[model samples]
Target: MGVTEYSAKKLYAHLGFANGRDTMVAEGYRMDVLHVWGTHELSTADLLEWLGEFSPQSVEWIDDSSCTLRCNIIMINESTVLHVLHKLAEPFDRRVALTAMAAVISTMNTHNNGGDFERALRPPKLSPVEGTSDRLMPPCGRWFKSISSPERALCLYLRIAHKG
Candidate 1:
């Protein structure tokens, strides 16, 4: 599979941790896997440069095809993965960024019950004073209310998570 397909599958696998057993397994696991793929001309240095501040614990190259190269990056935590996703969004594919975001959100939800995941997914209750307009707001509207942008919200979340 290509980089995008690999990322999507990894995200789905992480989402499966919604089940108790999988969540427990994921909690016990200390490393996160990131797949990076490109033409054979792409080098490890290039990929690492693209990753920016997020450093991987290890990188394993898979030369499965003549024209393409794939690397499995072992990262320290979900936060590092989030950092990588943010970098990817800036220069790489936007879909990869969304996939990574969904994976991290799923991971956060599994770990914390009263986190942004709950707030983002919860349907907003219509305020009697405001009438039914509140119902029209998307579920994530409340989560993003205090944050000026999605990137800022992500940074804020990472900051809070790092503090604890």
Candidate 2:
């Protein structure tokens, strides 16, 4: 589908979109196509550095504003998602990882035919949570360590709304 056609579809309603602007205060083009928000302490530079770790062909930074970042991320399969999750877990908290996963999954599911995300997060055996037979719970604690800091946490609001 064309970029405009893809953007027309309401792929992610959960991720809030700010019409006519990318960031909260920025007064430029309308870039709020896909918004991913989570608690994080990383700045724009740090985020760009993290993105650079991935393959150059996979991630293309179209816009890198002071308060906003627009990139075209190409996730080929579940392995890509896992790699992203691993990278996110390295520096950020569980919440941040979860948010990124959700955004990636949602975006993938929206464009793809079947639900690839279901298989990605599904546990091999039965869920360990009580009163739940087969809950879709991400293996957070087991997969990665949950670390929190005493200092104030910043919200990492990443909007993937722009197409170009």
Candidate 3:
């Protein structure tokens, strides 16, 4: 769940995984898992900065308009999915973390298709939208939502999935 030092959108789409930024051309390795922040409001620069550092082989599907997703893999890896889920809590809702994590597990694909991403837009547990958002996203969760806790829930889901 720990994101490395790479927040550039260029890194996310540099591989041209499919539906990536126009700046990217050639395709890179698709991911084995994916995490779509469908409702998260991200600036072009911010999106690029965060996604730019992806391993290309880490994502499987995307809801990114300015931020799409794609991935490659034989089977879904619980740890990989859980890792990404835990990272999504930052600047986003906590209750929705579980929902978002589930969505990622539900939407892993090689081709970049942002289907039914709106479901992720709503704030988790009735949380108000943050004032500092770079873009307009639907509100989710309570204002007091803790970031790390939600990630932990996602991790739980992944652990269960791993066991199953």
Q: Estimate each model's TM-score.
A: 0.33, 0.23, 0.24
Note the Cα lDDT for every prediction shown: 0.40, 0.37, 0.33
For candidate 2, the 10 contiguous residues with the lowest summed lDDT are 141-150
Alpha-carbon RMSD to native, per candidate: 17.5, 16.2, 17.3
Error of 3 at 85 (Å): 1.0
**How do these models rank on TM-score, best leading?**
1, 3, 2
Give the alpha carbon lDDT tens digit for every residue of 1-164 in model 3: 44343422322322222353232222322233333333234333333334344332323322332122233111234234324433533233356677887677556532335444544444578655665343344324322111432211221111011100
lDDT (tens digit, per residue) of candidate 2 on 1-164: 12232332222221232241234225332232222233234444454455455432233344332122233444443233334433343233357777898898778877775367667667788547763422223323212221321133343333332332
For residues 24-48, what per-residue lDDT tens digits would candidate 1 score against the true structure?
Answer: 3445532254543321354556554
> Which prediction has the highest lDDT against the true structure?
1
Runs of candidate 1 with Cα error greater than 4 angstroms are: 1-31, 64-71, 86-164
Clashing pairs in 2: 33-161, 34-161
The whole-model C-alpha lDDT of candidate 3 against the native structure comes to 0.33
lDDT of 1 at 118: 77
Ranking by lDDT: 1, 2, 3
Model 2 residue runs over 4 Å out of place are 1-35, 39-45, 56-78, 90-164
